[model samples]
Target: MNSIKPKFINVLFSSRLIEVLEFILEEPKTKKEIEKTLKISTSHLAQVLSKMVDMGLVDKRGDIVKILPKGEFILGVNRVAKGYDEFLSRFGNFMNTYILDDIPEWLISRFYELAEIEIAERREDVFSPHPEFFEHLSNSKRIYGYVTVFFKECINFFLRLAEEGREMEIIVNKGVLDKIVENFTEGFGKGIERKNVRFYVSKKDFQVFFYCYRCFLFDILLFKKCFFLTTRKIFFANLGWVIVPNSKSFIKAIKKYAPDKLEEVIK
Candidate 1:
C-alpha cells in the first residue's frame, strides 16, 4: 500500500477551496448552506470539503463546516503573498541587496496592505521636492517622519513646516541629527525650538525610511543601502505612499528601533 501525499496541490488548483473558506470566514456553515450559496452541486462541495479537511484547513463535523486556525492563516498568507509579489515585480530587483529583514515580520505579513500604493514621482522637475510630497505636507495638519539619508532641501522643508505652525514629530538617525545641527545652526535653533515640533535622535542606523503625513505611510527606495523618506538628494521626489486604517502600526514598528527614552535633539 502506498502512503498518502498531502492534498495541497488539490487545494491550490481548486478555486472552490477559496470560495468555501471565504464564505465560512465569518461563521461556520452547514454543508447544504455552502452548496446553496456557492451554486455548486453536492458532489463538488463534497470533494472540496474533503480536500480542505485532509489539508487541515477546515474542521467538518457532519454538516457543520468551520474554518480552523490553519485555514484562516492560509487565507491571510494568500492575500499577503499576492501583494509581496507585486512589490517584488517592480522593486524585486533590489531584493538581492536590500535587507528584507530590516522590515519587521508583522509588517512583511501586512505587505499586501501596501500592494496597491500610490506613487508620486517628480520626473520633469527633478530640482523641486516631490509634487505629491509637497501637496500632502501643505494639506496635512500633522506630520510624522523618519529620516535615513538626509537632504538639505528636506530639512529645510520641515523647517518651513515648523514655521507654518504644523504639528510635527521627527525621528532621525543620530548621525543625520548631528549633520543637521552642525550645518544648520541658526535654522535648527529656530525650527526645533518651536513648541509644535518634537525631534528624537535614534541611536540605531536607519534601515528603511518612512514619512507619515495625516496618518499616512510613505516609503521610497533610492538604493539597496538607502531608503529615503523624502528628499531632494536625487533631485527627484519619488514616493511609495499608502493610507490604511492601521497607519499607526507602521509608526509603532519604526519607533521600536529607538531607545526607551528617545534622545531629544536640543539645538
Candidate 2:
C-alpha cells in the first residue's frame, strides 16, 4: 500500500501516537490491546501502526508494537513545534494590540516603504536609517534644517504643508539655504514670508535641530562621515533617536556635552 502523506499522518497520529508510544514503551502492546486501551477501532489503529512501522518510527514484532528511537525523535520535535506555534501566536497578537495599532496614520502611510527597507537591512547586518526619524522631521510644524542633499525634498514637503497654513519654523544651513532659495525662488519668495524661516551659517556645532510639537525634539550631529539623530522628550540627551522609549535621557546628555551645536529652534 502507498504511504500516507507525512502532513496528514503528522496531524492525525501525533497526539494519539505519543500517548500510545508512552504506554507501550512502559509495556509493549499488541494491536488489539493498543486499540482497546486507546479507545480506537482496531482497523484504524492497525493502519496508523502500519504507517509508523513502515516509516521506521515504530517496531512491530509478531503482534506487539513499540516506539522506536525514530518515533521518540519525532515526538520531541512535534512537541517543540507546537510550543513554538503558541509563542508566535501570542507574540503577533501583542504587537498588533500594543505597538502597530498605536502609531499615527499619517506617519504610518508616509514611511511604510522606508520602514520596510530598514527592516530588511537590519536582517542583513546593514545600517539603514530609521523611518521614524524622517517622519519626525516631515511632521515638524516648527524649525527644521537640512543638509544639501536633503534640502529639496524637505522644502518640497514643507511648502505643501505650509499651503495648508500649518505653522512651521524652519532654519536652514547657509550653504543649502542658498541653493534652495535659488532653485525655488518664486515659490520661496512668496512662501517664505508666510512661514517662519530662519537662515543660519553652518557652524562647527550641531548640524540640525528641531522640536516636534512639544512631544519630542531632535538634533542631528554630523561627524566625519556618519551622523547621529538624537531625540528627546522635554530636554534630555543620551536618547538616541531610533523611536524607542528612553531617548529623553540621551538628548539631555548630548545637550550637556555639545551645547553650542544643539540649538533648540522650537520650545
- As a TM-score, model 2 comes out at 0.32
Runs in model 1 with CA error above 4 Å?
1-13, 96-110, 120-237, 240-267
> What tens digits encode model 1's per-residue C-alpha lDDT throughout 169-240?
677666667778888989988987899877777655534444332242444232222222222111111322
lDDT (Cα, tens digit) per residue for candidate 2, span 122-189: 11123333445556645554433333233354467667766766554443444545677788888776
What's the distance in Å from true for residue 23, model 1? 1.3
How many residue pairs in model 2 have overlapping backbones?
16
Give the clash count for model 1.
Answer: 1
TM-score of each: 0.42, 0.32
Top candidate (lDDT): 1
Q: What lDDT would each prediction earn against the true structure?
A: 0.62, 0.49
Error of 2 at 14 (Å): 4.4
